[model samples]
Target: MKIWGYLSALTVAILFGVWFSLDKTLLGYLHPIVLASATYLIASCFLFIINFSPLKKKILKIINSKSKVEDFITKKEYGILFLTAIFGSVIAPAIYLNGLNRITAVNAALLANVEILFIILIGVFFLKEHVKRKDIVGFVFLLIGAIFLSTNNLQNIHFDASLFGSILVIVSCFFWSMDTSLSKFLSHKSNIIYITALKCAIGGLILLLISISLGLSFSLPLDKLPLLLFIGLVCLSISLPLIYFAIRIIGSTRTGSIFALSSLFGAITAFLVLGEPLTVTQLSFGVLMIIGVYILYMGDNDQNV
Candidate 1:
């Protein structure tokens, strides 16, 4: 079961890596807020189908034996769920899309590694989740690898528009770290589908309102619809559910640390998807990140033992 948890985290890393890579191109077509709103709204609709589908009650019965049909989660848990929607689904995507607009896909993916550091801190200090020395050492390697990949032999470093964008991406990571910790706790108290659907719907609505208020263009290019649907279904819907499930089993620290590899996955995919050059230095950094994830996984296995 724990092995499955690790695999689920890996799957999330890959899917989100693809998303981060692909979204950079989408940003060229749509406003950041508009794209964020559309993706979340579409994902919410897909989740709604599942939430009220014919198989819903049966699936809920299998997954949530303790949950009453009417009210399984308390009010306090509901409040926390609302926070997850605000931070995770709403604010994080907004900031991330903004950053992705300013920077290249590879840079955005590399900077996303900061999310691991934030998650580890929250998981350790606030949540009182245990992490071994080995875990810290592994994350340190991940940090170094991300920096290396981002700088690319320390060439053309500038503190201008790109730097601000990187900062925005880091801020987005902080909110997401909060979301991961909160969602981990809530996953045990509520059904995963319910939690996911509510977050998506509420957050999507909030973003939609913001977009409308700002007079952002809501017109979806007919050509971009396929890409938007892919982001909605594969990345937002499937990826988020896997993330919540992994968090429930392995805890936020392990899951977030594993997600550091999204940078590596994104870098590899960029070669094929975006026609980005994959240099030897990038390849080396990717290898180091893989080792970091392996070290974290070993620490988790030791804890389970």
Candidate 2:
């Protein structure tokens, strides 16, 4: 991975951190599924508009000529795309939403850092990606920092010790991690804009139908539309594409390590915007996380991930 890859991952952390903080207000008023469905629908619509030209050209090319266009998507790619929708769009988010319902959004975001561990495992062992000594050392620092951040500087090393909700959040992280790893398979095989648009479309439609079938209302007051648009257009639409681009270039494991900063960013955002307190210990741990990421990429310019 180059600097852009790392930068993209870092941006995702910041975006999700801020989004989760803002999302707290909405979660207080709406069912998680209903909210997710609406935001995803908006994201899909926005992405489709961006993908429209290439989408039409590809369809026409396939029908009108035998020669492949640069952005042509294959059946195997579509299969992987659908799997990502299932894991990323539906299963992981649904489970995380339920877990988030039981705990604070900050805690839920912190718990999701466990996805880094799963990503590294799958990327290294399953995908056969290489690991350097510094990467391991940096990952150790990130992991420890994440632990400290979540546990309040070892005050709750057990991580909310006995909360089943916490466990649920971590479990959901694993599924999302799988989706992250699976996403790497799509990097060079298809045009991400179209693929991601379709992903959000499939996932959003499924979630919408499920929400309606469960008698959850899609209606929202005018006052709420602005925030909803921000969640969908910026958080969902923008963030998903950036993460995919980073993973495409950097590979999942390295991208995930940087993305783990979401926990620290979330805590700070909550403290600043939501009046949640940020203790000195958490700040210190957050510094360690920065150091970890810096060390993780110390020699990245020398070689690509």
Candidate 3:
């Protein structure tokens, strides 16, 4: 079961990497906000169907019966959860997808490593979680690697599409870091299914409204409907639920490390699928990012034992 959990985490990362690649392709036809809203809406429906199924009834009952205070959840708990969805799911993806349109997938993936640093800062200062000295060193290496990859196109920065894209990706990382920590707290009381469903549903609905208010065209690309549905089902619905379950079993530190692996997967997918060039800077930084995550994972295990 534990091995399954680790595999699931890795699988989620790989699936997300695929999603990022495909999503970039799809962006030519659909707006980022529309894509994100549609993906999450489909995911919500999928989760709701399973939650209402007979097989899930017993689990649902146990989750509902768990008292918030006793389980470290309260009315305030739901508030934080909802905000996490708003920022992390709704806002973050919208920004990221739009940003990816302007950036190479490899750079986007490398820049995402910034989330680890944000997570560490949040854990130590805001959440009051302990951070080992080794973790700081690991983060420093990761940051340096990310910086190297980001500046590879320094001479072309003005001509490159990645300038604004990188900023959006960093913002997305902040929201994601917050979401990860908050979800860790909420998972103690709520069924992973319940929390995931609620987040997607609420977040999707909010994005839908925002899309409408902004007068963003929601016209479906008739020819691309199949691709859209495939993304919605496999990437959004299946990957997210399994990700939550992985978080439950592995703890957030390990989960974060595994999640970071998505960058590697993204880089490879981008090279193959998007015909993007892979540069030496990207290669060097990618290895550094992976090593940094491995160190974090190792540190987490040592502390746990």
Which model scores highest in lDDT? 1
Show the colliding residue pairs in model 1. Answer: none
Stronger candidate by lDDT (1 vs 3):
1
- Higher-lDDT candidate of 2 and 3: 3
Instruction: Please provide, for model 3 over 89-154, each residue's C-alpha lDDT reduced to its tens digit, 9 standing for 90 to 100.
Output: 888899888888888887887777777677777767886777777887788888877666665635
RMSD of each: 2.9, 4.9, 3.4
Quality of model 3 by C-alpha lDDT:
0.75
What TM-score does model 1 achieve against the real structure? 0.88
Against the reference, the lDDT scores of all candidates come to 0.78, 0.73, 0.75
Candidate 3 weakest ten by summed lDDT:
62-71
Clash number for every model? 0, 1, 0
Lowest summed lDDT window (length 10), candidate 2: 60-69
Ranking of candidates on lDDT, top first = 1, 3, 2
Error of model 2, residue 267, in angstroms: 2.2
Across residues 131-169, which tens digit of lDDT does each residue of candidate 2 receive? 789878877976786565455556654545435566676
Candidate achieving higher TM-score, 2 or 3: 3
Tens digit of lDDT per residue, candidate 1, span 166-194?
A: 77888898999899878766756445776
